[model samples]
Target: MTMEIGLNLFSVFKELNEDYFGTLEKVAEMGYKNLELITVNFSTCERYTDTFSLPVIMKKFEDLGLKAFSAHEGVAPGSVIIDADWDRIIEENAELGCQSIVFPMAFISGREDTLQTAEHLNLIGKKCKEAGLSFYYHNHAHEFRRIGETSLFDLLAENTDPSLVKFELDLVWVMRGGYDPLTLLEKLGERCDMVHQKDLGMHVNPVNLFTATPQGTNLDTMKIYTEFVKPNDFVNLGTGIVNFQETYQKLRQLGYIRYAIVENEGQLGIKFTSIESDLKVMEKYVQGL
Candidate 1:
């Protein structure tokens, strides 16, 4: 299928609070036809699984004319994925009708940490494959740090099995990592199945591009990581420095057909006017493509 526009529920996590179903309803109403789920509360998952069941949750999405395309497992960095939990994870996502499961981020201190993260990814990716689901690793700016001549991201990509472990490239973070998004996209090629469509507003300081932050930092203190981000650094789709037109063109040329999830992480205390506005921006850009 040709790739379509979707919203990462994380963009509106704070606004929605713990209203998981309410968020889905609001997002669909806002004209987002697809969703990339982020687990804000583990209880929310249990509530759905225990009371409604996976099919019921899927039905809820169907009722609203929305598709749950993918979900972030939302595990913390450096945490081991126990083998026993693999079945539960796979089953939950399968029932949600997710085509892929993504490991959002991993805390890597150095070369050793990077290697350990890669091993964990491969292990999880293997189990995900056994359950008939694609597994992917989502990137942040920290992955751009070099271990030697190659980046940590390159190490993970090189070590993991491409068939089992694809990548979800976050464009904004790619720029923040001091690399051209297009160059990274070219490097990943077919291994890239999804891209996070976040825009960077003007006034970004390239000098602070590679500033590394420790992984698994408290969510409440996330704003500290945005110390380098200007007030307008995070923005909606077409309103910022990211060249969506050229990026989409490259994706098409590369025959990349995967979801483009609009993610506006409200870091630096910066918030978008509304999620609806963000969705509108993406819709207009995708239509033009």
Candidate 2:
């Protein structure tokens, strides 16, 4: 099965501030048929809840010729689980025609936190299953830290119910974590349904979860690191170290035919040029596949 190419709306969060609907229209115009929503604030959440109901949002997507396949909810650990607000969250996404609800990132401290995260994911996954949506965990580099001999990511994969919890593997962050992306894919196997396609320019140090920059220094403050020492950062796909051709071949071999979402946290560096270039690169990759 061939995977569909999609955009994680977070890639253009800054541009969306200028023109919300227009930004989405631009994405559709760029040939992206699917979108993965990112909810970072109440205002963003209310954009979907207060301004547009699920059916209204669905109609808008249909009009734009786009499909809402998945959504990333809650930025951190404390906010990731299902709570009193889950019904509304689930209802809204369900109405928007989203099949997956992904917890984008969790600021984990150690083994205990990792286990707690796994338990929370199981609970959330159960809730999602009851609501007819699948639950997934999107990883960053922190998950690669070793808990004894087993990586926290492996622990999470081993502990969670395979049917309840899957993963959205961020290949760039996997590389940042100093692990082979394909090796992790081999381990996760069928538990991985979605992928975040990104590439790294240099070797970034493993994230310090307790520190100020969990996901690397913000692009704005990147100059600070450069003044003292060079900082490894995300670069556009194909222009970086990731081998997409090999990665795509492995995904096909593993039967990963779900969404392959192109993501660029470094869009600020190249603005829209690199994003468009990377999308075209992914488009070409998908066509060849």
Candidate 3:
């Protein structure tokens, strides 16, 4: 199956907060038919939906010809987690016509934390399945921290149920973690249900994040590591070092992978122009596929 170009709303977060409908219209006009909605804040449970109800949101998406294909959820204060109103969250996402509910990120310190997170994910995934929606776990560079020769991500993969849980692999994070995304893709195969495409600028020193920063998974350590990742470290889709052609080809070969989502991060100042450039590059890649 040919993969479609999609956008993660986090790209234009500032614009969305300022003018929700206007930002979305611009996105649709730029040819993004599918979207991965950022429903909740990473640090807090403040939901964008709290400002607008489900029906209103659905109507807007329908009117614009945009599909809410996936959504990001997490454990924030008052946010949708395993303990907090998860059933309602699932019902609401289903009502919004979302195909999948994704747990965006986690802070893991060690093997136990990783395993526990995986167990919780299994529970969430089971619930999502019963509600007729797929569940996915999105990764950051922290998931690649070594634990007994194996990465935390590997441990999570081992602990989670294949039938219940899948992954939305972020290529930039995989590279930042000092691993080859293509090789990781080979290992993940069909379990990688989606991909977040971004590129590393040519000027990024050491290239691998783990190389310069110490391997620590705590929040403070993570923040310290983030400080090392400058805004310029990220470039538009095909302008940097990532191999988009191979990535698209690999996803097409996998046959089950769906959206190759455009994740325009670290370019907030020019989010509109960045995504437009990304779409041009993505179009070529998809055509090749």
Deviation (Å) of 8 in candidate 1? 0.9
Q: Write the per-residue lDDT of candidate 3 for residues 211-271, one digit (tens) a residue.
A: 5666444434356456777777778888787777677777777777678888887654578
**CA lDDT scores, all candidates in order:** 0.74, 0.75, 0.82
Please provide TM-scores, in order, for all candidate models, with all chains considered together: 0.86, 0.85, 0.92
* Candidate No. with top TM-score: 3
Models sorted by TM-score, best on top: 3, 1, 2
User: What TM-score does model 3 achieve against the real structure?
Assistant: 0.92
> Residue 236 deviation, candidate 2, in Å?
1.5
Residues 148-240 of candidate 1: C-alpha lDDT, one tens digit per residue:
688878888888889788999998788777788888888888788689988776655543254433332222223435554565667666666
Better of 1 and 3 by TM-score: 3
The backbone clash count of each candidate, in order, is 0, 0, 0
Instruction: Give the clashing residue pairs of candidate 2, or none.
Output: none
Q: Over the stretch 130-233, how does candidate 2's per-residue lDDT look in tens digits? A: 99999999987667766568777888888889999999999877765558888888888878879999776645444342133444433222222444223336
Where's the lowest-lDDT run of ten residues in candidate 3?
A: 215-224
